[model samples]
Target: MNFFSASYNSNQDLLDHLKSRGFLESETVYQAMKLIPRGDFLPVELLDSAYQDSPLRCSRYGFNASAPHIYGKCLSELEIEQGNSVLDIGTGTGHFAALASYLCGSLGRVHGLDIKSEIVNFARSNTETFKSKSGLNINVEYFVRNCFLADPDDNVYDRIYVGAACPKDYVHQLLKALSPNGIMIVPAGEELLKYVKVDGKLKVQYLLGVRYSELELPHQHEIQISYIQHEREKSLKVLIPKNGIDQSFRLLINDQKFSDVQLYILGNKTPINVHSFIFYCRIPSFFKEFIEPQQINLSESPLVSILLPDFVTEKNLMMVLEYVYCAKLIDPTIFESNNSSPDQVNLELDNLHETLLYFKIDSLVEYFDNVSTILQNPQPFNLFQDCQSKHLQMLVQSFNKIPENIGTDYTFHFKGGDIDIISSETVPHLLEISDFYDDQFLKSHCESILAKSVEIDNVVCLYILSSRLNAKQLFRICKEFIIENYPKVSKTANFQDLDKELLCQLLQDSCSYFQLLFDRNDSKIKSVELNETHSQNL
Candidate 1:
């Protein structure tokens, strides 16, 4: 066996030795090897031996970072060039992938595949760290995939390097993933081999004798578990507050620390200090009209002050500034006094909407339109009149800012917890308003709340309502609830309210559900019996 006769002190010394030994034949190979530090990819315990020519164990799955000589010879044999898209099969720790990325440069992309997510994640993290430090402008993507099962139709690369010993049967499968006239370097059995495709034929050449782990398929149960885990990860929902940058900007609204522009309202002597850039992006017309004409440098010039017209009240201007900073309308109740009447609140909101439209903040103008609807319909049947003002104000503030397609439930992320905004009795009225206003965002939220509120007392009526509204999700939930608690649901007063045709449909659906369950249980029994019989015979 050939090995390094002496230990090296650094990566450059190792590269110099490899070049002298004829392993590193090309300047691109030498530069790539020198640019990427091997110590960064090694485990903490093996960091001292990173410059050694011998392979080092990297994972419990029996993967190793190949010796420097082997990598150099492979890169030299592969003849990788700039702008060549490459794929690294069984890419562990991403050391070779990083070097390949540097070789490919800015115009090319590299892909790495490993079956273990842990290995893939480690490789991705190491590559990102290298990119950050070296400032490499290349796209190197890592994926957790079974190479044998990869779909060749998805993508083909100009260069493919297999880091594991591929079985003879899978060679043709991998060759299918190569572009016309593309080259592949792979280790098969005890000999490293190179294959170049030309005119739909593989021209093979033997490179060297090397021992490597042969690629193997994961177990059936492992594949199933991996798929289920992937699905669970894909569907994971996170609740993030809509108040990060907007909140930070809101705090500096009237603060003098970074203010470059000042506005003096008609009645208030205290100037409203503000950042000029906020207005520059959000309300460009206002910024150009008031702040731009001053033509003062933001950092070096004095704070320029402008007097507002009579219509821009101090109170309304403050609210406008809040909206300008937050990218959301302030709660109307924020400026309203405790003793303020509904009529007073309405008048103030009307003035605020006019101000928003005049400044061309169209989105916030649309938000106040919905707020007007919420105020008009305080509660379903006016049940909670005392808390209506405060609750509805919170609802309008939170709901208007929510994204249209926020996943699954409609819970507001408040503080660090979820706050449910919809009450059981209020769903129908809210649904009506959502439909009338052509607001699919609010309609989706109302349907989700209404579906959770289904019960024996109201399942029949809710079912009819869902049908009337053509709510497919709510209809399915109500139908399933009715089927599951049929005995109790049938005895309810509103059970007879279901018409004859709809009642027959529910009976048919229940029969289909029971029949499917029975068939699944029977199949399981037969499978067990066949297994037991085969075991007895053996």
Candidate 2:
């Protein structure tokens, strides 16, 4: 509501100096800088370097009057126009406030805040003197506020300039303080961040970075809500700016020269050369028993060779390993299938399923669950035989087929990893030498030993399996079966072939069955003494 004008031609040299440095682009901003002489805002001793486009120390505690170009950039980003209301958050020495006041002209007003009372008073005094001496029609209100706070309902400022670095979450407060269509300029991390309020949400852009002090804000529980949102966005690479740095483990898996890996899978004569980095963590069950990732010294020792059993083929093993490393099935190249053939697709899917199941790798089974039903549907589409994993199906039906796996490849299921990752031929030798491979599954080559109709064969094999594989459920079931049916099973020919130790265990576990088998002969004889006599007879 006042009118006055004065000559600002005195700092035309400083104003031109700014323009020569490729700054002060907007005509209104350039005119605003020209009108507000820099000398009035700086200390008398610091006036010599005030025209330089760099931040100058305004306080003993490491605060600055932002450089001319930085202030110009903030002004340009603010999009200041006549009659626009502005809030300058850390108005040190009042230079930016004075420039903002000039741009807002006779119709606008500027309010400024600083945390320290001394700085706020100095800036207030400086702006008042500049207003009187220059005869400009501007009144900028300066106040000391330790924290950024404004009523959301009463927010009227069209533009806000933060004179400090703000945390990523402080955008919420900045948004709350701005009028509709307002812009806020603040420093976040190593970059200058600009946010514009639109549709009640703030959209952000990273502008150029500059050194600035941390902004002061009050504690409110709602701050976490904004911070969590910022963290979520930043994790998805939305808010953080990228510096070019790349890392990959492909060379460790594929390259031959590094040389810590030797995989001797069954059915393949050549050992697989792999880096420990590839499989050590991926196949934790196998690696926990065999590989040490950190203590690997490949050059000092002969190449570490591992042998897998006959049931696990090298082709199936390699495909699953590649999938673990790449997170997708490798392109179909293993079996030389026609690219368009439906049989080839089914074979690939079956191979994937069997490989995962054979290793008892339950974690990877979920990946094959969504495999296309066309490859799974055998009755209607396939002209040949069914292509599902028969090996996997056999294991699943093992409970129903009671002892039918004798002469079949019996996969020893070990938990917490007590078995060696080697061929069954090599493994039997390990068991003979030491207790290291204690978990063993042995099915005799004699088909009569595992015949389904023979209850004695099933009971003896199930007992042996339960003991060797540490299968508690099977052991309990076998105990109950032997207790109830031992009288009938005692006459089977397979009972004569059962190991002496199993015979003694059966004698020890069910004493009443012994009496029943003996037809009440010497019923009260000492059981331990009888066991010794029975062992000797066997």
Candidate 3:
């Protein structure tokens, strides 16, 4: 009795079957698959299932004539140009070799080798039955011997297929005989791997998971799937954290990092069913709602087939959803509290505000606006101007601006230290805040523009401000002002007064006195000056 046991219930024509299942990726491969009649390779007992792409027992211990899916993918990836030499190892049924012969045509040399004598003889008989009538004039040599020990008449092969599984480490030995630019397809342990020799080194790429065994043939698997589809394994973790409702919903929408299996829910709508995992983790406490995904919202747009609200379209939803995911990826400290910068916060709030208003998510507009004021009102970022309290207050009316895009990177040198500012990273770093409604996040992005204007007292704070908040553009100007006036400024009382000797500490205070004085004042300041006589009278 054969060691491997298989259950084949699928009813499909073998050529169409493997192609549909994705075992065959190209017209060349499908044509090659059609060249060999699978029925001729199998024993009489398996004729009923001959057209199917499942392994059949030829005789005894786990000797499987590889299904069309297995051989088809290998052949397609190899891309056998006419006249190329081909090798098949552990070729039990010669079905794989037969297909290879067809692709190589009249000028190609194809050889099938098996370690077992009976299987080699059987494969030879099988090849003989079809070779002549098949109308493909390709000579194939069959041998019963270990491929590792066999002497090759030729120095290298254009393409090689290994019918049995070997450890990934053994790939090097098989690769030795592969010509430069040749393709080798093999099962390394439980994984199917392809090796190509490029510029004199083997470059390996993982094809997919495979189960090749001497004791048992691999379970029949559907070879081809849609280009966008991904097969799901039952062990995938869907990231349904204990309080993970939002996470699962995002997974349902973006589905970028999840599995490719489709889940048919209510309303004829289908979404990617992520990798199968513990079902409990995939769905939230309210997961019963997904039983009917269309029931998610009453406003379903039939045109796009995506369930959404009035102002936001399917495209908008995807964009906003992506932004939400990006926000989550950010370090919480950037938007959380003291760890983050205000210009970053203000910049992020502005983006969120624009998106929210466009989507007419009126509810979030106020939240983002409030957060913006929080950043703009407080010292915002540690970046300070060398101006005093009065001058800084007057400048606040100028309104700090966040650029839609940053193009130039600048370098700044301060008595405190030197800093490099990146233009692109500034906004992404600020948008790290997860929630606009978070009060602390709102407070982090206030008016550093005003404070820095008041005094160059914390030049180090300005340096750190640009570094941490990625507010390089704003601080770059401030840093240049300091560098230009370095001689005069360094001699000032303020430069000598810094408690910390080094300009930049790992982390230091950024908010300056202007912000403190502004927040303390109940009324706006009007510029009033005292003459020497008036000062003496006071």
Q: Which whole-number lDDT from 0 to 100 does residue 23 have in model 2?
A: 60
Per-residue lDDT for 358-452 in model 1, tens only? 66666555556786654664432211011113222222332343223231122221111132544565567555534432334455566777766
Question: Model 3, which residues run further than 4 Å from truth?
Answer: 1-12, 60-62, 150-155, 214-538
lDDT tens readout by residue for model 2, 336-398:
555647786676667667667654455456534644432353222111111222322222332
**Cα RMSD for predicted model 3:** 29.5
Better of 2 and 3 by TM-score: 2
Better of 1 and 2 by lDDT: 1
Regions more than 4 Å wrong, model 1 = 59-62, 218-538
Candidates, ranked, TM-score: 1, 2, 3
Off by over 4 Å in 2: 1-14, 60-62, 150-153, 199-201, 221-538
Least accurate stretch of 10 residues (summed lDDT) in model 2?
238-247
Predictions in order: lDDT: 0.71, 0.59, 0.52
Q: What's the CA error at residue 82 for candidate 2, in Å?
A: 1.1
Worst lDDT run of 10 residues, candidate 3, spans 407-416
Per-residue lDDT of candidate 3, residues 491-518 (tens digit): 7675565345334431122234234435
Give the top-scoring candidate (TM-score).
1
TM-score of candidate 2 to 2 decimals: 0.38
